[model samples]
Target: MAVSSLSLSLVPRTFKDKLNEPRWSESPRASELPLHHAIACSCDRTTGFDEEISGNCKRRPLLLGVVGSLTASLLPASSLLAQEMPANYRAFVDLSDGYSYYYPSDWREFDFRGHDSAFKDRYLQLQNVRVRFIPTDKKDIHDMGPMDEVVSNLVKNIYATPNQIANIFDTQERTVDGRDYYTFEYELRSPNFASCSFATIAVANGRFYTLTVAANERRWRRVRNKLKVVADSFKVLDI
Candidate 1:
């Protein structure tokens, strides 16, 4: 549950060595904000079903395929649900999107590009938590490929790496409510600063959901376990 230091040299140097490359942008786009926030912010908006009906509905099964070459584990729903949130954490739920997670109660929410939801430490600009989703035809994560390949592609392409050093520390796949979720732990280092992030991914309702929690590398050791709580707390609710 704690974040550990990693040697940069041991990681594969798959990206071009661009020491002077500009720092990657972590801000979310303007257009992407509305879709994610609309549901969470619209407290009075009604989706028609009553409270009783909503509580009784069962979650749909996730049609996951074989997770190739990767160690896939089944997370017990009881354990996940049973885990207690720390006193300093607060729950953030998006009923319309059918997902929920916990974040540090002290952190303030922010609008970041392409992210459905985002939060930042009151003081540290680099410490953040964000969630985003993309439409997909695949029903399960395995449809994308093996865990290693999927993570490698994600780091190489989607993540910002202008002049950054990337390292993969761990990869885990868990099943909850019949859905397969992948959690990736990694570090990104630059000439000026370094950061570590934990990203949880899952496919549901014809879309891919990703929730990422990050902090400055210097602060990682102090906050690792707390961030893991945020990562593991992510749940795809039954819609």
Candidate 2:
């Protein structure tokens, strides 16, 4: 018999720093620095235990209904989907939340307030993926209403903050396992900095789920495809 090896590497912080501080405050919410951990392992097929980027080899559990208002300028954004998970990406499943998605292998876990699960770039705090969910009576994402109206309202009014300008560039729809999902692209610009993101939403298992992956506007063109992988991978599983 052969055994697989797994390891976790924690980035160090100063003694004066609180263990879980929200670094990105300009946005609506904050980030709890779980001191992002690097993990190397696979989900145990037999046990069904999903991998969390932590010191342990495996752990259980971890949503967004939208993200911070996305309006850099509503350009003609295209719907980009990945047919298959890439070699560089890893699956993140939250059995507790009844949702799962794929993230980049190098990204690590961070405690983002009000989110079910979140991962960020080791070097760039601004680049990340986050999930959030809330109980709902609605059975499908389409229940929220027309895709354009829902996305426009979400980005402009819900996700964007007081200081940011938001806009929607594109919107798309998909059905998986008979469940409908709404996916969209948007950007947010503040006086100081700007960011763009892909957001996917669905309703299932009595919950409304949202997943968003983002990168700084300056690097959006270079990393958008990779982030789209995370966005397209969002799926809801039966409880």
Candidate 3:
């Protein structure tokens, strides 16, 4: 008897596809990232598919909900165990309380908020990306708006023009223990700015987590990538 090879191995097409799954439709809530991953992969899996081809129609992420100690268990079972996130990432733990997970290398953290900051503009520049965090609660559920309106305001105020935003790259709705939230990325750059921006919003820990990064378009491409890692990695503390 001949030994059999494992049935499925996914190989993404295109350089972008290799780095990430094709972008999904813009999400209106931050709690849908997991589902968006499934949906986008589903779309990609069908396109260009030939019945003549033989492979697993594996869509969705390798580690759909793996995090913390659970990740260790997933390593052996998950098909994506071989995949790795960005090197510069350090897990962020809290939104309003300001806690974070440290890199094993002991990368020094930066101060985004200065004296008396109210979340409009507190940032820490990393590599070519600038990141900021904002927190909101049930009393302040105003941060999230309809996708069109939010994008409209962002394009107008940030770029001094309404039409600057084009081609939404990816969107997902995510949650931590059943709260609602979402994240979406718009490809944008303006005259006054040196780079484009990838903005994100989420509701976790009874608070909304928002971050915007402005950096060279090419350099900042990983902004949302890292943000997604952070958002998806979030797990509600045992409360």
Candidate 4:
């Protein structure tokens, strides 16, 4: 299956011109305006403009409404993204190491030799997430090699067992917070068992970080979207 990408913008706008408008000498009484309009114009007092305009203050609500509408429209997509995030998951931030991500909250941390951090599902033995880093002399993921070659070598040399056959399904390159990341999806089938994984590779703070999320092939289809969320959440925090 093809991997999908997600994007979000969270910046809010400041209506400086409307906010800086001069106050009128003679202010209209609150009773003179409609209830909603009166409430909207009340912002002037809080904004340090003590006086109100004599003419229809309808423009205040319009200006405020424009700003409010803009904010309302921009917020839901991002908010829904957050709200719909798996409730069983929680954020993990390695401040000292300068990396952060979200993982299944119920999963327990474990020592997976050579990895900086690792987590495994409580119920599914094959479901796991791991992050490891290596000091990189190069500055970026591309410097190691082309994305395909790098991912191929990683699967064949590191993940594929001698008796197992690995098939690459999809690969994607993305940038987050100005850092580039290469993500790959693949399946490894052995004589007895099969597992699928999504791995993301990136370079930051002079180290190459690899985050892998895996599950039994039988369960992969059911949980691929959840695992993808974990895979995509891996990020190098700003130092």
Give the whole-model CA lDDT for all candidates, comma-separated: 0.59, 0.61, 0.34, 0.60
Which regions of candidate 2 fall more than 4 Å away from where they truly are? 1-83
Error of 4 at 27 (Å): 48
Cα lDDT tens digits for candidate 2, 1-239? 00011111112223233222212111111221111212223322121011212233332221121233321110101011123546676666544346768788788777654455688899998899987665566777777778887777777766777788997888999988798999999998999988899999898887667798988999999999999988988888776
Answer with 2 or 3, whichever has the higher lDDT.
2
Q: Of the candidates shown, which would achieve the greatest lDDT relative to the real structure?
A: 2
- Sliding window of 10 residues with minimal summed lDDT for model 3: 1-10
Superior candidate under lDDT, 2 versus 4: 2
After TM-score superposition, what is the CA distance of residue 46 in candidate 2 from its true location, in Å? 35
Query: TM-score of the candidate numbered 3?
Result: 0.40
**Distance (Å) between predicted and true CA of 233, model 1?**
0.9
Quote model 4's TM-score.
0.63
In the predicted model 1, the residue pairs found to clash are 27-113, 28-112, 28-113, 29-113, 29-114
Q: Kindly list the per-residue Cα lDDT of model 3 for residues 15-50, writing each as its tens digit.
A: 334224221111122232221221112222221101
Per-model TM-score on C-alpha atoms: 0.65, 0.66, 0.40, 0.63
Tell me the TM-score of model 1. 0.65
Better model by lDDT: candidate 3 vs candidate 4: 4
Q: Which 10 consecutive residues of model 4 have the lowest summed lDDT?
A: 1-10
